[model samples]
Target: MNADDAAADQLPLIDQEDRLMASLVPLAGCRLVEVGCGPARLLRQLLQQVDGLECAALEVDRVQLARNRSEPVCPGLHFIEASAAAMPLPDGWADGVLMLKSLHHVPLDELDTALDEVARVLRPGGWFYVSEPIYAGALNALIRLFNDEGVVRAAAQAALDRALARGRFTAVSEHRFAQAVAYPDFDSFEQRMMRPSFADHRLTPELIAAVRQRFEPHCGPQGARFVRPMHVRLLRRR
Candidate 1:
């Protein structure tokens, strides 16, 4: 077993950003790219805390991209509308590439090409941070009710392992942690999770009702809170 396979369930709950920042300290002042950045919430936080860090945030959703660009632009931060399979960035330009719970969303057929794009953009010894949601968890069970990701999620890991076996990257570390996810009610969950702009999760009336039936059980006055288990793999370019 490699160091990247270290057990994570035994570890206590902690903020994902805290774990990420600990490893990112060395990359301050270096170039970083976040694929499928979505709202770039974490990138905003990183820009605020890390000095001189240049960031390229890429997202495939044009609607979301417009919103991200409409927000105040931070120094050294650029937003691009792009996919992981074909990043427009130049070769060996980034010190680090991050995929925060986004790899599994890539088309299964393009997984290899996407990883190749990541490897292509990262300089030798550059880091690749992949944060994927673990298949087991209360939140995952609920999400799986409508949008089952078992196949894609498993494919994401398998692609990573293949890349490693091919000497594309050296395994560095693996971390598992549970993140706190809260939904003020079923509507909040439906709007955010079910109606995301990136993909069409076709929700018929029957499907919506079915999802609500399962989700309502977890709701209370303040709302439903579930711990989302996450698997983070850190690798270095070979």
Candidate 2:
């Protein structure tokens, strides 16, 4: 698995992507939509895994969404530039929905709306898969040097819990795991995770230096390795 996956914390999210897709049996030709699909990478993976599955992706970052849309279409793949709280998809349009480590990125005030939107799109008995990065871990410690996600992460979970309380969907599964994010060197990590264009984490020169100082301690002969905690919630629309 690459360092870009958001679902991996204790278990390898990429390695188990196929397993997760296959677990949704009898869905060979089902329609699925992913909210907050960064670059639509998971969508591509699912398309490859589930033959004849119609897939759609929604991304708040227009840059990433544009790039993803420009990629050669894979028959049933579609990409849209929109936020989770305000997707353009029609109600009851999807058989399932996936959110991979992205709910926290939604604006705090709009989180519940986004969950409502997920329910709106999913047909009754459809599934909603949510994977989020937990707040405690070596990776979180290091990344907090530049961008701290504590508040948003907690907010995301609270939103998920509140959604569950409404009883519109029934919880089917809950999982937790950790995964290793390997960087050949500090440069790679800086480029990929530190100043990623998708987020608003702007690093100043001083902050960059601070991050370097914090990150250097973890670097070794094989480069830096970080263990990130992840959590997944599988729910079914009732």
lDDT of 2 by residue, 129-224 (tens): 888888776688778888889999999989988999998688988877765678988789889888776876778989888888888888899999
Query: Which candidate number maximizes lDDT?
Result: 1
Candidate 1 lDDT over 13-122, as tens digits, reads: 76656446556437678799999999988878878777888999999999999999898878888999899999999999999999999999999999999999999999
TM-score for each predicted model, relative to the true structure: 0.93, 0.89
Instruction: Name the regions of candidate 1 deviating beyond 4 angstroms.
Output: 1-11
lDDT for model 1, please: 0.87
- Backbone atom clashes (below 3 Å) for every candidate: 0, 7
lDDT scores of the candidates, listed in order: 0.87, 0.81
Candidate 2 ranges beyond 4 A from true positions: 1-14, 24-26
Predict model 2's lDDT versus the native: 0.81
